[model samples]
Target: MKIGELVKQYGVSVDTIRFYEKQQLLSPSARSDAGYRLYSNADSQRLGFILRAKSVGFSLQQIRELLLIEDNKAAWQCADVKDKVQLKMQDIRQQIAELEQFYQALAKLDQACCGGALSATECSILTALEQGKPAQPETHQEDASC
Candidate 1:
């Protein structure tokens, strides 16, 4: 099939498909006499695999590694694939923990402000910031007075 057909079937932009080609993730099986890219059924299945891997947060490099493993399934063990998934899960967990810390810090700052028509000079949040005080998660006070 042609590139346009593949784009319509996948619901992805032309640039996205072209970028995948540039990234060496997906390649057309052939080129038409008119210089248009033509894909085979195998290429369509490969594209699907790439898209699904991306949706699951796999980086392009990681997807490349996965594709290599997939292409040579006889040379790779199931344990190898499981190890990659476990590593990705660990990375995601660490990111979530860091984001939670950021959220807690922002929440503490938000709760410190009364949201009244007070002047900026009397803002406790600003005072805390000016003092270079680090957000202590254990010291979340409920007082909303500025």
Candidate 2:
């Protein structure tokens, strides 16, 4: 198959495929007698895995590691893939904890705006922001729903 058809099949673009090739993520394929690059079904599968790995927030380095395991079938035949995935899951959990903290802080600030002067300087929004702390607030999820 040609590069263009591979893009259609994988829902990516020619530039993306070319970039992957340049990154050494995709191996160079055979060229036709006319010198056009010809891809095989394996190329399509590799591109698909790259796309899926990216969708789940795997970095290029991580994807490369996965590809190495995939190619060898031994890197993961034991417990290496499981360990790597466990580390990624731990990182994701830490990020979620930080995000929840941010969400709570923002939700807390919304309470100050409920009853305060309407002017910008006197505005609870501006005052809280300038002070970098809430002046006695209650956190609620509904406050941020809007």
Which model scores highest in TM-score?
Answer: 1
lDDT of each candidate versus the true structure: 0.87, 0.78
TM-score of each: 0.84, 0.77
Assess candidate 2 and give its TM-score to the true structure.
0.77
- Give model 2's clash tally: 0
Residue 38 lDDT (model 1) = 94
* Residue 49 in model 2: lDDT: 91
Question: What's the distance in Å from true for residue 104, model 1?
Answer: 0.7
Candidate 2 lDDT over 75-110, as tens digits, reads 466578888788788989999999999888777777
Q: Which stretches of candidate 1 lie over 4 Å from their true place?
A: 118-123, 126-131, 135-145
lDDT of 2 at 26: 94
Q: On residues 2-73, what C-alpha lDDT tens digit does candidate 1 reach at each position? A: 988888988988899999999999999999999999999999999989999999999999999999999999
Candidate 1 clash pair list: none
